[model samples]
Target chain A: MCGIAALQLKDPALRPQLGSMMHAMLCEIVDRGPDSAGIAVYDVERFVHAGQSTVTLLDSPSSDEELSAALAAELPSAGAVEVRTLGDTTLVSAAVDTAILTAALRAVAPGARQIGRGTHVANLKGVGNPVDLAETFGLASVSGTQGVSHTRMATESAVTASGSHPFTVDDDLCLVHNGSFSNHATIRRGLRAQGIEFDSENDSEVAARYLAMRLREGDDLTTGLENLRETFDGFYTLVVTTADGLAVLRDPIACKPAIIAETDQWVAVASEYRALVDLPGIETANIFEPEPGEVYTWEF
Target chain B: MGVLNEEVVDLHVSTVRELNSALHKAHDGEHWRVTNPGGAHNVAVGIDSEIDVVIDGHVGYFAAGMHQKGTVTIEGSAGTGLAENMMSGRVHVKGNASQSAGATAHGGLLVIDGTTGARCGISMKGVDIVVGGNVGHMSAFMAQAGRLVICGDAGDSLGDSIYETRIYLKGQARSLGSDCIEKPMREEHLAELAELLAAAGRTESPSEFRRYGSARTLYHFHSENSSAY
Candidate 1:
């Protein structure tokens, strides 16, 4: 079992409390998953710089200086590159075309794994206690309007930094999963034949890639999730975050556990209610479990 | 009886063992109050005697699981497998519940004041589940006995491969599974449903519901039924 928690503030006034609230939620579910933890923060102002693309990297073999030099040589048109280290991941922000910069970074640091590329989303993940990982990344102090976090138990693939959760396949898009996919291999082969590359052997990564492909083809968030329902086979409770919204979806069978508690100020989705019990205004929130095959989305 | 006071245990400060031990040691008709459950899993499980347990906050998985002869009430939402495999007595949740709320339960009354997630009564052998709100997909799957009363909507595939478990739905059903057909509600069914509603503290009229059960088409395998299979 894995623990997944997501929060989207309906009012921007609550953005400052997002990190601490998410940290508290993750701590409640530490027993559900103790192998690894990850969080993707979408602070519109802090993480996302104007005219710049932020890329998160995991297991970087090169130091910041070497990586910066390589990026400069690969993309001469790109501006200065700034890198911040957090645990095993690095956040790189540069004023350049996102696609070009992503490709250049991939080539320069072949040993480094890309976590996500976007304007607002910055992800940090590692193998350890979720609480300690949160502290290491200063999650309680980082401010964000919306975010998604996960604590993984490693049911399908090896437990490593590359295999950790909060897998992002597109700009400002990330997915955290709580269950296994039954037909991922078949779908993975299909995507590969269509020229889509994968970074991990995780089933949830395939789902993120599938949704990203759909979104890239101009499908809306709701339609992409609906298509996901038709194509994927498994028991999953997914918390998907985008540039403007957050969504919660369960498999058609609804085997996995998920709860949604919403108040006037925010919407929170977690694998269990205890994760939300401590949230502000939870006592009066309208809490319910999302129905199977239904995508519940809240746009910021 | 006049001198005995109701026992109160705080889950925030006391262990589950302490609360359960008190229940196990209490005599018949003893009342216990559990405060600050904080959504802990497996609370108040395996009770074998007639008693009363009132939990003041949310509970996690398997709350009142394998229960017997105890009336347990949760004031907030429950995690998966609430009252699972219960053999007797009544278990009630005042708020929404997670998946498998009454899975495989036998001989008990499980009531939810709000909605319940998928597989609410899956694989139930003998139990009566009454939900004030909606029930998720695959509810009552492979049920062998007892009844399920849903006051609101039911998600996809209600009563798949069910046997002898009478389902009464007051609201819409997305769809029914194979061999599970909606049957006409008769006078006897109305009376039975009325009793169940009363037991669940609901005031809805039984005539508003429709009954569903097995069509007996898949009960026996034969060459003629090969295509159906």
Candidate 2:
């Protein structure tokens, strides 16, 4: 069992409270996923800066200053490398190409695994009690236009930073899942045959990779998930967020819980309504669980 | 005996366990109001006393589950397993309900004023369920005995592998499950449907509904139908 929460603010007025709102949601679902936590933020100013690429990775043994100096020497064209650390995740930013930055990141911080890369997103992951990790990361202080957080119970993976959800394998994309996939092993073999490498043994990573592949192939968010429903077999309630949108989907059987609440200002989806009760304007929001095998998306 | 002075308990202030513990020992004819439920779980469950309860907001899983001899009125929506395994009494939700609204309920009347998710009355044994809105897929699956009245539509596989239960549907079903066939509604069925509708405070005419029940083909084991299982 896992808990998933996501919010996409339609009105910029509510963006300032994005972190506080999501933190409240995390607190409500801490009982569901006490093993670990991960979050992906889509704000430009508070987490990741605009007009530059940011690469998120697991914490490195090397200090940010040392990594910055190594990165500066590696790429002369990329100017003024900056670093930010939150809990067990670190963000490295530069004005260079994301691919080159990621390649340079591997040489400088060999121990760090790049989990996410984008100009508008920052993925932070840690292994601990999810609520405590959120506190350690200072989630309540960050501001964002959209974000997704996950608390995990570790059904199919070990309790490690790499095994967490919000598998942001692709740039400007994030995916979090709440149930296990019975046929993930078979699907993983197929994707591996196509030269798509994976970072961990978690089943949710396979889904994230599959979605990224589909999105890269020009399938819109809704069609990509429909393809996932046909190919993968098992129970899942998932939330996928992009630079400009957020999407929620449940497997056809849909036994796993999910509720969605929408207002003029924001649209939020969670594993349960408890995660959304403290949100502003929730009492007046249009709330309902999505139908089985249906994809619900919101664009900011 | 619990104190009679506790007439109202705010869930944000008191715990769901405290309310349930108080309800377990409640005196007959006692009334209580719960405020700010905030989508908590297991509210007002397992009570055997004839007490009245009103929850002011949405609830999480298993609200009024395994219930008996109590009336739970929820003013907002409910999460999964709403009123599951109920033994007796009445549970009402003024808003929509999540999956398995009344699974494996042995007795009682469950009233959902809005749409219900999948498996609305799976494995029911004698409880009566009235849904004012649509019911999702696989509703009444393997139902042994009961009556399910849906004033709105039903999703796919309605009443699959059902037994002895009667379903009165006012709207269309996407598809019927194995061995669940629509049957002609008799005068007695109309009388019972009308009674259930009235009990759930619905004003729909009973004549607009169609009755469905088990074909009993799965009752006797047959090798020819083994694949259908």
Error of 2 at B226 (Å): 4.7
Kindly list the per-residue Cα lDDT of model 2 for residues A166-214, writing each as its tens digit: 9998888999999999999999999999999988989999999999999
Q: For candidate 1, give the lDDT.
A: 0.89
Which residue pairs collide, candidate 2?
none
Scored against the native two-chain complex, candidate 1 gets a DockQ of 0.76
Candidate 1 lDDT tens digits, B1-229: 3115778899889998888877888788888889899888889998888988888989988999999997999999899999999998999999888888889999889999999888889999899999999998899999999999999999989999999999999999999987899998988999999999999999999988999999988787789767966
TM-score of 2: 0.97
Q: What are the DockQ scores of the candidates, in order? A: 0.76, 0.87
Report the error of model 1 at residue A295, Å. 1.9
Q: Worst lDDT window (10 residues) for model 1 chain B?
A: B1-10
The candidate scoring highest on lDDT is 2
Model 2: which docking level applies? high
